[model samples]
Target: MTIRAWPSRRLGAGGLAAGALALAPVAAAEALYVPEAEPVADGVYAIIGPTDARTYENHGMNANYGIVETGEGVLLIDSGPTAFSAELIEEAVAEVTEAPIRWILNLGVQDHRWLGNDYFQREHDAEVIAFEQTVRQQQAFATDHLEGRLKEAVQDRLAGTEPAYADRRLPGEEATLALGEVRLELQRTDAHFPGDAMAYLPEEDIAFTGDLVYVDRMLGVHPWSSVQNGYEAYQELAALDPETVVPGHGRVSGMDRVERDTGAYYEFLVHEVGAAAEDLAPLQEVVERHREEPAFQHLEHYEGWHATNVNRAYLEFQQ
Candidate 1:
């Protein structure tokens, strides 16, 4: 993970923009679960959550979120899991800067990424932005997301989270957003979910590759993910030549980590597993052949997810 020098001049409550629209204080019990924000670049912060599966202990905060200072106000990349998590994220940002969250771009359709939109929009009057595809997917999968693993893990913590869609929708495959001095180029691709997207800071050379890049953890090839498309999307991200990468789920890192974990792993799957499937290799043989692959064994959840990834890739290429 890449760490940078912290910015000086921390702001107090009076520094909040929008007439000091700071959220009410969190209860003492929820204070303990707030994730701390770490500076990754000038006026950019990342709240690195746990790399484990969602559970009661972690309160479904297993995905990372980003805080970017846009000079005028703050821009949040991904909102947290629930209303409480959003409050916690708000408090964490308050510790770093007094700027209120003015704009939010949900990078994907995952439950944790946009579920907090309701709170931010209602409280801070921030404009929630997402791709048109993301909002469609969010509407389509709201129930399953609420009742699936998230509910099973977080239980009561899932309360108060509403299905709030984006207030502003960016259509098409690409768009550019300029907030104050910060400019972000948004690109949507079929990588992790129905509407997987990434935000790039051209001037800073920072890329917030949400789910398109994972560091210190193995990327999952879900039933909907396309290995071929994922690799192609990775190539597009690499072409940008970003100096820093804030992945969807892990610590802030450089392009090398993104290449090693996500790009190379996807390349391996498409070439090796795709070849095995083309050769009519049996499923067991394919799984066994790549079970001990050394390249990504050091990543968390490798043991649990690698085989499943191989299996999914093989199935994908078999057709």
Candidate 2:
């Protein structure tokens, strides 16, 4: 597949400056794009991309959706980006749990969190949970980015199957659930994306980190994201010390792979960006230069995202 870069159009000086000024606001737009959902753990599950959410904007990327089993029933973390994908997850959950989907925790406020509520509410009557900031991000995404894309995504979800949605609202910093002998913990971390959260199963030594950890793919950054937050988030991952780390996308890997790969990407970002900044290279040029780095060589169809990540890194370094 041909990879595409994040679109950024520059106007004349006057317009260019205005557009540049608007970068932060535009970057803040919260769009949820997820693809097909999949089963990750024995009782855990995930969906990779284009699920009921816009996938074209972020270089056709998708957020990962996860499901954890609980004693009461099942707890879903971050619904796919649309109603149809949510329906698929619901089906998957049903296979594992006869009880109703009791709690739905949105790891963050992106469309991946709230867009599929209609399905859960209508079908299984699942109650959605999210951080207060996550709710705000969802509102921002709905108002700023979800209009056209959301409609298309929702329609796409409804195309081949019955329509669905869920009931949703904001949640607290930490929430716990019991599923037989397993205990699931949903904890918030201020990294990667703002208001990001993780699902931890201490018993399994497995952690579901949304976009916070990318196994082999390059991480995304925006003008609104804090470089420190990204760094600190990595540190948090180091602290969790999970045996298995399931990223928002890509294959599941050990904690060592998670730490090494994530750290390598960040280190590459800092080093490369520093060099580019020292020479005062433009973002586009910097992106082109590192398009073939060894660290990113194995990513499937990654050129488009590599350029975008480079641009993001340049922007982060500038700040």
Candidate 3:
């Protein structure tokens, strides 16, 4: 499948006010059922789900997740955002291999990243693991921000789609996961928030970069994000020089695509947005001005998230 950007649906009349949107948690993406799972390596498979909002149509499966067979059992990448997605993912994996699933590993810190934990815990007897920071981020931001957004995002899909957090977590550093014949490496990325972790499987020459490497999409940087750190993270990921990259969203890709596009986006944003904020350009003014720019004109969710990214960047500098 062609790697494309996710399209965000329109919000209600006037939407939430700009201020409300700012303070609100990340709204989810939309779609239905699980997409196909493609093999990244010999025994590894991934469903590179959409990067759109977790609305009804999207089925709360916007974030990508993967599977790796360890000769002993199966090790999953990030679980999807809801019980529905978790069910679809488990079914999808069974379609390929009958091996019991051993674990669900998280690649990002967003609430949606781990909400599928309940499914694996209840159905598969699997443990959901994430970085320690991922757990703290959930406790710090989940209770207030995510639950309602999830309730609104799922709608009727909310029936059995309970929110689940990571039951086990790794420290915020380099750690190797030994799953029999496979070894998965995990770490935070500079390209995304400090809490964002990218998983690398050196034996297979593949790295599930998670949201750290968004391919052909408008990435919303947190207000306190650092482009420089992103630059450094890219360098670190590039050093891995993997043959396959299972991004948190978008289709699984090669290292070359990750090196070229994500870095360019960061460079452009840091310079242009950084300049505008330094010039004391108000958030709305900067957003409007950039809306007229050529660089982001063709991006899939440009109208929806580009301005929001600018607004977040501006707010960071303002603070």
Candidate 4:
């Protein structure tokens, strides 16, 4: 719970500067964190966040969350970035339905997805849920996430944000959650993060793909990322053929967009990079050969991230 005074990385332009600027003055920060509930179906809403990088201006609201009106109460898929952002999410949900938030699902261990759980649990006593592996991952990275880049970007906006692990952890790869008359089928995937998940609404035929898919922005392949596993997960989710997909980032889209943006992208990285690694191709050659990929060049941050993604995938495959 200690807000480490980590040195600001970006100094003048957008960095949380040393003194008072680090605080980001909640009023100004809140302005950019406003959650606009976009309706995906009757009573189901996607609170899409910014596709840009996390910064003080955006309050780290860089991941998408969901609000589902289950007749009896509301079911939230992935909480926002901070306590205040959670409040903003609540306000946005109020515009759509008057129901109180009953359940909050942490689709992945990502900070934005679950860091706001403490706020909702304290305020509305919402039950937080995630897969057991996800809870472990959250427990592992909670400190780093809270006190790491999130604090650097949003600074004091992350105040009062505590790591509230999921109260309910489901076992194995998948399970079905029945809330009132609504049923959300949750499946665990190993795509963007360890224990990332995607939810399918059988009634609505809509898929809430946690971090398994990124529709617009280029995905970051970290040391923990597995291109092989990610593509496999994408293939499985694609097989389900969910009519509509609420990607972890970007707009609410369909399977075609998911295939083009995430499925094909992951597949390309794994196949190309995997083949190169097996042949002992140099990392630079791999990076150079795939840097200007036409299919994904249009995505936000593609130029900046594509090479690093290729490098990471090459290293992962090499191992």
User: lDDT for each of the candidates?
Assistant: 0.84, 0.61, 0.70, 0.84
Which predicted model would earn the best TM-score?
Answer: 4
lDDT of 3: 0.70
Q: Decide which is better by TM-score, 2 or 3.
A: 3
Candidate 2: residue 62 Cα off by (Å) = 4.3
What is the C-alpha lDDT profile of model 2 across 1-319, one tens digit per residue?
Answer: 1222222332122123644546656554444332334556777766555322244343223556666766567777776555555654565565556767766777765555556666666666677666676666556556543455555644433332222222443367666756556686777665666777777888878888876777766565655555456666667777878877778665677877776656667667777775686668887778777878886666544655666677776776665
- Cα lDDT of candidate 4 equals 0.84
> Please, what are the lDDT tens digits per residue for candidate 4 over residues 114-138?
9899988988899998999999988
Model 1 misplaced stretches (Cα beyond 4 Å): 1-32
State which candidate, 1 or 4, has the greater TM-score.
Answer: 4
TM-score of each: 0.89, 0.71, 0.81, 0.90
Off by over 4 Å in 4: 1-31
Which regions in candidate 3 have their CA more than 4 angstroms from the true location? 1-31, 144-146, 190-194, 224-228, 275-289
Question: What TM-score number comes out for model 2?
Answer: 0.71
Q: RMSD to native for every prediction?
A: 6.2, 13.0, 9.9, 6.9
